[model samples]
Target: MNRLRFAPIPAGLPATVPFTGPETLERRSGAPFRARLGANENGFGPSPRAIRAMADAAAGVWKYGDPDNHDLRHALATHHGIAPENIMLGEGIDGLLGLLVRLTVSPGDRVVTSDGAYPTFNYHVAGFGGQLVKVPYRDDAEDPDALIRAADEVGARLVYLANPDNPMGSWHPGHRIRAMLDNLPEPGLLVLDEAYAEFAPDDAIPRIDPNDDRAIRFRTFSKAYGMAGARIGYAIGPAELIAGFDRIRNHFGINRIAQAGALAALQDQDWLNHIRAEVAAARARIAEIADENGLTALPSATNFVAIDCRRDGAFARALLDALAVRGIFARMPGVAPMDRCIRVSCGPAEELDAFAGALPAALRAIL
Candidate 1:
């Protein structure tokens, strides 16, 4: 080898990044967005108590956070009626996903997820040199049985399912999902992403043994708690698997201010209830807007609605582009069938008003 030569990057690395943030899009467009409803962020925002707690914790920024996450772990355990040993906290579900991928995946190892599900998990799996095998959604909802069969056939190291899924906002009853899981082949872990659980029905959440070693559940304060910026998320699973995180994770990743915010957010049940009501109202309004625009809105179990563009993927893409050009931020699924719909997150009235005002112009320009 030449002395001047340097090591090259891996040949199998992905050529494209997963997503571009809204800010990046704005910078490219040279116009600020009037509505920020594409990201599924709660525009209603965090609870007053959470704000106060974060403000109080701001003074302690000079010190490093507790590596064990002692207080937050204990608080979460008491809240969920599970032992702290069963809990694993991380920067967010995104970081935890990377840790799990490292723990389970090897070069060329098989991993299963829905074709158009969360892309971040797939990114992590690919980063670890795992092969991703995806199953398509049936009627906009993940075909759980099909995914399980695929996982078994491939001897998958991980199976990813997002309840009340992103982009589509579709969900199956918890019992139905549980039935599928009961028949799922062992020797593989089922990673259930419950990021939007709080917005779903009470029965939408599966009842699982947190001590079960075969599976893990991921939850986030980002979605329902209005703490997306806080970067707080957690995993619930068997003590052994939960402990695996400590070995790979950045121990003090969760900042003290975030912990304080999340704790207060969790305690403010009334604020959460209010936000839920607001989301429900926003969903209904979105449905009405869709109907008025000669489209149909899918039944949603999360803080977003998927409106059928009533056409092919190209038409949907055109519509989305039109919306973006008009300063309305929105998104759609990555594949066909689902891609025929545009996903819009529920937000405050002003944001919805922006969407409503722009729909007709977007449709006219695109159609």
Candidate 2:
């Protein structure tokens, strides 16, 4: 009789997940959250066309998804004005990060990222036994130069940066990002997570050049397109580098329904623009709510806003717990300094109203 055993890394690591879903939390609390905003999901929902397309694809669930992701890949290539060879579809940006780590990061290889940039990327690095060298955030944003410097200093195999970063919702302008791409240490690839790119200003988005070897940009339908459940995203970069993903990528990982939804969502530029406008208004409202309570809301280029709690991490955590108790699902950064802010996702006016009604009471309870 033999008990189950795993590889050395899995055998030694604790059972920890990057995120605990709202459903699980609701189950424990005995009630669903009033405003589900913690996950940074697009609450306005996907395009009606996308929803219909997904429904249409539902009948084909019995069949395997196109392993090549051919049609969708060509669609994204057209959307970005790049060649299809430069694009590779994956389960999501999260999956792409995992695949990138697997492709480039041998155990004990150095990886660089901002201290609180994106925990899931860090999660991937850890799972793959890569040594992470974290640089601190500069003014609540991912410091591009600092990340590049760290990568060069450590001779890193990978450097991760999320433009208009998560948790903090801060962003750097395009020129600076282009500089980072140009100056990124050789032999070390840049993993640019643009999950929230649709919400950003024109100046905040860097140009996508398929021939650029310095970075591979990952974009998803989860945020602005309101398809978080779709689990579809695409990566654009040098054709050869893009092809490397074939070595280890899950051939049929992307589902048929998700593929259809993402393709429809991409073609619906009108819907994407509408979402951008809605997100912008919601960001302003979140900032306004923070101001009404005498807290400061940082400028955001993403679908969420980060309101400064005006105190330490302990207070922020207390405030977050209070929000949870009030059935509001806001989240916060998990580290020092940056942890003094709470992140609220952009949602419908009604959900934002629920948040506004809960904010004062939650703050007072924590106080």
Candidate 3:
């Protein structure tokens, strides 16, 4: 270890990007993927209104984004039935999570989460020198009771839970979540990631107060809005806690174009409804394809499916590799038990066709 270090946490931690993006894979192979399905991006894409707004806003790129994120925050407040003071905006949920860690986590602070949860949150915790207490998932779904139990035992200050969770794509009902919150011990702040809530049933999202002092819920425009590149996300929390973000947040982090596009996307509910139908159809197709190839596709509320390879992590990895070799970009969970499945993002019929066509061949090679 270096005697004179600026940030000791980063100095000791491995330098890595949590997720290997599709473009990076393409560059390494010197060939582009046939179907981009690894990242759970909306293949249906943003609404026409959003696209037009972005194009219009693009001309004003010279101006900085609203530091306070006023208009968008107000619009979101109206949409969510909350006060403007209760919200905070950032580049993305990932960025906002980092800020939350930076603000709340001192050296050695304990953070609790599921064993095979969103790795990005773990990455942020590590960066801030927080100790993560991970609990195991119950039957491929994130276990709220188990997580709460671990948090209380550890006397954790923070707990991360992704509703309509990533990778596994399973979620519990709102009542279970509310009960989890009710049982969470004092000062154990909950980081509720609702990135895929738009795709989930309404009952999956808890009806929590916007000013719940013990929780901050995050939402993003990247998934259902199909604007992952825009990097627009926001969090709802207690007014006082939301104000604290002003102290350390990158005020102008969200670009001008992204803000306009997000607002327009929010207005076009019809387009969102259409995308939902498309995602539903694609999910069915994915299940059908998996059944045809003698595989089991887990029921998903998120914009992706985790198909069980009926084997170990190595087998699932081999299947992913086979799919990659066939020019289909896909991914798998990193931790065990959950890692026995490969994640496939929901997309349009054409993209799903590519995945459907590649699955049997990929399986044959791996098997």
Better of 1 and 3 by lDDT: 3
Per-residue lDDT for 64 in model 1? 88
Whole-structure CA lDDT of model 3:
0.92
Model 1 misplaced regions, further than 4 Å: 1-11
Q: Write candidate 2's Cα lDDT for 209-269 as tens digits.
A: 8788888899998899999998988888899988999999989899999999998998899
**Residue pairs with clashing backbones, model 1:** none
Highest-scoring model, lDDT: 3
Candidate 3 residues lying further than 4 Å off, grouped into runs, are 1-6
Look at candidate 3 and tell me the lDDT of residue 194.
97
Q: How close to the true structure is residue 6 of candidate 2, measured as C-alpha lDDT?
A: 82
Return the number of clashes found in candidate 1. Answer: 0
TM-score of each: 0.96, 0.98, 0.98
RMSD (CA, Å), each prediction: 1.8, 1.2, 1.3
lDDT, residue 91, candidate 1: 89
Question: Global lDDT of each model?
Answer: 0.90, 0.90, 0.92
Candidate 3 worst ten-residue window by lDDT: 1-10
